[model samples]
Target: GRPYRSHLRPACDACRRRKSRCTTTESSDACLMCQVHGSQCVFVDSDQSRRRKVPTPHGRASSYTESGGSNVDHDDTSISMAYSGETHTHNALSDGQSHHHGPAVLVDPGRPHASAITGSTEEASMSAMLAESGDSNTHIISPAIVDDNEELDSYLSSNPAVGIRRITRTSSTSTNIGPSSRRVLFNTVLKKPLGIHARQSLAASKLEVIEKLLEPHGTVLIDLHTSFRRTYSEHKDRLSPALLSNLYANAMTYWNNSPQLRSCHPPDHRFIWVQANEALHSELFLSPGISTVISIILNVHGRPSTSMFGNGGMVGTAVALSNSLGLNRDCSAWDISPGEKALRSRIWSIVVLMDRWTSLAYGTPLLIHRAQYDVPVPSKEQLAQPNASIAQYAGLSIFLAMLTLTDVLSHYLENVYCISRTSPIDRPPTSSFHLETLLTDWEDSLEDDIRRLVIRGNDLDRAGSGNLRLSYLAVKLLLRRILCDTTNATTENEGAVQARLQTQRVAEEIVLLVQELSHSHLRGFWMPSNGFTLTSATLFLLRDALKTTNRTRNTSLKLAKDMMSSLQTHRVNDSWDLADDCLSNCTDMTDRIEAGRTFESPGMIESQYFIDNNSLMFNDPVLGFASAFDFDLENFQWNETT
Candidate 1:
């Protein structure tokens, strides 16, 4: 076809230069582009005599006429530009409607049109497109829509489009926001208002179990019962979501780790532990020192056997947080209340004690030094007050005694087992004697009530006292074993004999203690005892049974069997596997000794054979039993009197 042309009016200069179709009505003075650009309309000369096709004026003028002449211009190009702009605005409005669940009106009554051309053509074209597309929900911007300033403000305020833009802007810049800023934003936008009834329901259902589990240990470090009560009473005003989530995580961990619960329900500790672990990373509790410490404690307590090294590192983090909060400093000089000061002191003391105990357990270096913190210990008066809650009084005396015991252990570790200054060969024998004296003195200083609790208390009290006594016994056993090892490494026979005798005495003490506690008591005490004392005692019995030929051998073998049987009943971890293997090894050794005597080949029994066979038993360093006795003692001359 030949080039199409508008015979009614020639194209304007700007439209002709752009090769775009242009039309004008009797009402317009310029093309839409020329008018929009504020330029004069100069049309190109065309062959007016030729009859050219003139389409009907289906542009802005007709639409304005159709809309009852609503003061709109007759410019097709301007109407197209306005339509494109409103199309973009319409898409944005649609997105806002979907996201915010609101109406799809694109036009803001408060925002005026950016140009003089009315949007009547744009609205009519959009309506036609929506109708053709079968969309009945399309909202069009009306040219005559008007509102007062207050109404406009209210519309803008209630409009989802504005809120969407604000949200978009915030998310776009969220990377630059700090944790506290993000926390504030989350609290405002994401956190739902949880009611007290719901919180109490959670507390009564799950947190109560946690409080019970924690009550045994919360007397000194954390008063979970009191804290829970306070939180239940003042959660809306005082507790942060992070703290609440952290507490929930801890409760889940306690629930998961409870042996009673595990026996009833299938094992879900891994799932609950992971959930609790993720809550620790939340930004809300990142800066709060006490919550962080509580999280560490719960984590350590949850997996006592597997998390040794990890818990050591967490203890370092706790110490750093404690120091950052000035918890290491004496709070007495501060203007805080005496109760607050006492609580702070107790927390610091707990951190210090935890650092020492974990360091000793994992053979890691201590994080908190004794001289670094001057926080006072809790007074007896504070512990004995009648107003003390169950959580406050439950383990009060035990905790105080443990504080003193941990102090003694810390001193013993520094002086006798200080890795930096001493090696096994370099440590003097007198160091063990010195620590023994100190340990004895420390035990002597314990109150008579504590002694009575350990000797004759019922099941619950006996378990607690057994835990305390086991700790002291473990330290004493460690010292004696160290002395024995150091002395055995020497060529001096006299010192070796003395160290061996002392080790046997300590071992016998431990065996007696273990025998005194029932199987249920031992099972209850297993978690707190860490199996160190039990393992040591079992090793001693095995060694005595193998090395002796007198009637004491029968007693030693019987005791070893009983202890192993008790340990076999409870499966805390792989530690019990080593115990079982030791028991088997002892039974075999006793059988061989009896067989050799019966066959008149007692001299044929060789120490080298026993050493070669039993060396594999203690390959696990945690067992540490293979080196407790010299299986090659046949090489040394026996002294019957010694």
Candidate 2:
């Protein structure tokens, strides 16, 4: 049994974690301790993986290898996470294939590693953050992991060989914070975003010499902020990883910027984008600031060509950050400078845009609802102002147009799309005429830049214009669909008939718009977010096409199929498989000509973003344990399914 001395081979990660003796000889693959416990046999250089010295292929010092072999482990945190199935570990020296040891790291054996970050399933190698910290605030993870903070600390301290103790700190003066802020370790944020994972990876990649790569694409991403020079001048004080990583991710995705950036998405550039996200992931919790919120806004504003519909959590985080920073609240009356106030409004405007887009697409509730925020809309004078940030984000006209259109979308979602209502929803109101009036007025007010038709090459403003139009069309489409879905055939009126015909017409416009504006550039924008409505539109069209055998309705059905074909590009380009399901449903429904056609919900993607569908109608005993309340289900008629 080992005491405090460092072993030649060192202990495997799990064994070292518990400070147990590794009873394996030189010939055994796994030690007796690991084999008996049914754990993997892995080796790692110590000093918190960051300073672990690994020899190069030719037995030379790798440039990345830190000199210190006895540095203190600074990875201590109170919030420890526990994983399921098996103990998972990650190491920084992932690519170093060093079976042979170089410098020996002294083992304190009194403190256990608790900074568990990314856990992987690989048994042969390790990466960053393996062992879980035992922080009480760590919440229960779904399916597998949970934060068993106290239990883990007790287990580590219980070992006779490993006398692990919680690390703590104290301030010399009573100026900084109360006793509560000081812990085993505290985060001291620097002027610049220091110790960023992306910055480290970027340095490791040695991409500074690649100025050709940086200027063409990286510059374009910088311009996205309106004027990078102005943005830089304003913040010339320091750097932020959240902001930098967001730009990197934007260039790497097929969604944002110009075609030039997306087309030149080489393997190396894409790798930086991937690494950028890892950096952003670290920044997600490491710090919270304006740059972090902007990074999140950019992250959700456009997606990587290969990513889809998972930004719900990211959007929620942005909303929380926005509220915390007073982005949702009006800063106009504040004593801040005009530029700063304008910037806040712009950022808040986009946050609202992304929130509604995500909520609509995922069939979820609004994070920042209408009544929740008191921020005022911008005036014509503000829109007319020559601001770099405004221009960088498709000008103020486009923002205003989008802002108004999204207001209508939010109204629809808060009312028509809401599953729960104070009273039964009015399915077919005689009119969505007022909502239509607002939408039409917004479209009419679009300035020359966003209103201009796409004549030639990829005009960035045309994209803004096209996307704005698409948003308007989608709102109009959804409004019409409500009338169509709720109107019964037994009492079919002229308005209901017109609404049905209008549904097909809107689908045609959506498909045609996708064809015209180079849809990939828009990243499927409002079209896909209105997926449920799209499904509803397509199904109703198909029913009319077959039922009446009308050539116009048939043509509408054809357009719906063509639109699906365009969206299919997301499957190949964005790595989303959503089209296959909806497409198959359309095809299968078409094949079964004689199936009963009293249409129900779109049934495309039954997204449970935040609200539980079951909890809305029925109460569960587990959730309401010891409660006498029961839903009167005796009179509730469950729908008969085939």
Candidate 3:
């Protein structure tokens, strides 16, 4: 008779285990068993079932075949097989079976088909196995138990199949796991078993330390202490382990850097840094708000090696987060409280300012385009409200002024430094003239008190005055760089001469400002200033000194030398040796002039030097004037007649 082939499909694991019939109306959807049990009805292929057949004592087993021809005997009655692809296979062997067949899954009669069981069944099986052994000490092999490789050999006797075949476990190597896995592993390994009270105490201690360290600068943009306390009290869930760790890391870094705390033993800053990074990347704390911004700022500012030009992605992330929160839009129409709205406005302003600064520093495109945001600048009265703290008022005032200053910078960047079909080389003279007019207007528009604060350094807070003045000088330098293009002989025209003269005056202003700042005890106030303004001033003075053989040349050389000395004293990260090399060259030229010899220009040698080192010159940290459309200073020739 012909063999009868059943037309009905085989039952799924659940149905088969329950000894119930399984039915599927469609091939793509769940079967009756899955629908009723609310479980996945996975059907094993006919070939797969056939492959699971028990092998004869001499016949090669499927396990052996699947394991790349490794010899494994499957005749042991204690051993069983399971069909789950996601789980590891366990084999148990009877004493009669050869141990030479790969590691055997040890089975207990109490745990019937334990290899094929899971959940409550597996738990019940383990309990029953313990009772059946009577001694209550019978060893039950489980997946968790199998994770220990050292205990593997003692559990099973030598079997060629088991000994030769490696047991795969989850990788301990951090590099192999995803960020989430690494974070989980880090939390598990580094977590301390401190009580809730202890954790709160530790957090309080850290917050105190951070506030003290950050006190000198004052909380300008975001009030870290206030935000943290508010969140900790009311929105505790919002503060994740990552955020706390990052906050601690930032505070610790500041503390460690503090001159007063240099003798104290700090925690492993690197570990805290990694933890903070993990927290930032974790899915638990992606909310865009003051906390996230503070975290970003701390991460960047805490790391001494962090460069303004580098870490564009981190800056971009912050910009994106700010945008997502609609920080770019005016929130007056919203029903939010006045204080909250004010905070948002200030943060948005800061984000925009930072975006522009980074753009200027790295020659990167601006993240916050002027057209995308309409948030009005906060008024001085609004920032100086009675509710605002003294520090807050001071910080916001300076921030507001700096924000306005950046507006001018942003325009300069868009108009002159922007890349387009009409390169800066092709920029019309009127365009540069209009930008200069804008700069002059911006300076003129400054409040009389603020102007006095900048020039006289009296009465008003000096927190942002230096930055505002330096920014003005930087913009002036940028405009002058454009107007004094040596490649265009037209620069020698009357208009060009006027531009050069203005540029010289701006350069002189920068040197004077630097000298003033250097002499003051509040020099640290200007430490936040990049190397751009000073670097540009130095180069300009050096170049002018080289072109002139008069007494003013000596004065220019002296100023240039003085500026370089101040930069060195400040330990400004030179990244490039432009300052040092420029000072050396200026000294040599000055000596020749002093010797009363006709100073011969280096000509192509100087041009090649400028050309080869153009990147270093434009990208100078102190001189944030370099933008995407930077002028080719290398093209400037030493005119025998200035």
Candidate 4:
């Protein structure tokens, strides 16, 4: 009545005897699952060594059988020829129907009458043991041939089973940049106990590729870092290699469109990151000098990781290290040399900036508060002015602007947001006038060159200038929302309408600021902060669109759709994902509004359309309930289940 199920590939002996499943795929052996569970894997008969059946065009199935019974890990390199007399013949026995496109299961025929081996054993990088016969003819085993020169990602996608090959650990020091070699090194360091020296050697080998990739941009990456923290420039060579790896990784974020940069940045970023993680642990357990703290900070901003080792944990680690080093105290007046005092101040300022960022990002309380530390802002003397490159002045300007902006954020989060407030947690917010005064004072403090850039929102085209302008707009936007957040009686008043208009104006400014940011260097740097900025602005626009008519429909829809596409392109962090949620809600609102539907808002018919998607504002898998406006929205008190 039904088609026959091919029994060519059988379950392994361990799986059959124990009545469990063996995790074998097209290019791998049956030992993976057993090894994971610390059990021995065995195949009972010769037929069990074959792979599972795959579909053919004629509704028939085909199975590949290896010639020999040994479960050796297959070489992931593209080996083009079979040693049989016929160049295209293979060890596989397929159905009579011709299979046009499929994996070329290259195994030795093991037939006694097969022709003798012809290839010289030529060594390849990262354990790619390729057999090259020195002949000009490249044998075509099947019509569907995977190009030998394809990139690692493409080959791995089509050859999923190749990455699944078990990493056999040996004391061998050689490694390569191929997918299989990376897997081998990953398993060796994680599964097996690799010595520090062996690990160092492996880590050192990974650097060769990085050097070649970065050769075009000499010390641009390192120089940019030195400009930001002149202290780092002073002791640049003294910094450990592990910390340097992390610095390079962060620099890659600025040029994310590059395929090479994307493959090596952070958290789950391959090769380089593994070595960085080791250094972080070693420093954490020990004193964790300034270098380690800098590494952790770079990791925090490079990209957000959801694990405990992510931004939240890294912030805490950096904070603890700062406290231990007495960074919270005013090191400026310390009896130390000018260089040493400036170094401590600069480090503390950056640390405080990140502490606030992670707090907002994770919905946690602020880790650095004024009451806890008396550290003063870094003076220009702290920034390298004497031996400074021309780029140093621009970098130093941005660095100081960031420090002052951190003060503004700290005040808002402490006074307006309440999560970071030194006083009672649920205390009523202070007057918006006080926060505005603080902003005005900070604005006055800005140098002439920066003040000019900060005022004209459209001129914020540089990465530093763009981010700086966005940070300033954030406080202005928050203030407008708070002024407009009112009870039922105030909803229809002229004041409420004016507040919404002002807020809308701020959102429009943000939209202008982000028009060039979709795929630019500025977007890649400080990405999470940029994600939150875009989300807040989008939310405001979507709210305006939902309450208004069809005139603004196209702009809202296009912006949201474009944002969703951009965020999906990188899938960088939880913030991007949350921002996507905001875009999705905007699209849905536009559709519903265009269809002549009137919806009830949570508060006086102006609140967001919190529909069936209950996880809209909060409930991200990693940054749980840490919406773009977590503290601000927590005050809104919208009922999700409703």
Clashes of 4: 2
lDDT of 4: 0.46
| Root-mean-square deviation (CA) per prediction | 25.0, 17.5, 23.5, 22.9
- Which is superior by TM-score, 1 or 3? 3
| True-structure Cα RMSD, model 1 | 25.0
TM-score of each: 0.51, 0.52, 0.52, 0.54
lDDT, candidate 2, 385-496, per-residue tens: 3533433344345546667777877776665545555655643233557656655665566665554432111354322445456566667766665556555443458767
Indicate the residue-level lDDT of 307 in model 4.
47
Which wins on lDDT, candidate 2 or candidate 4?
4
For candidate 4, lDDT tens digit of each residue in 95-167? 0112132333433335322223221211011001011111011111221222222333233332313322222
| Model 1 lDDT tens row, 106-177 | 334354433332445333322221110110111222223211211343333322222211111111222333
Summing lDDT over every window of 10 consecutive residues in candidate 3, give the lowest-scoring window: 182-191
- What local distance difference test score does each model get? 0.44, 0.44, 0.46, 0.46
**What lDDT does candidate 4 reach at residue 514?**
52
Candidate 2, run of 10 with poorest lDDT = 625-634
> How much lDDT does candidate 3 score?
0.46
Clashes of 2: 15
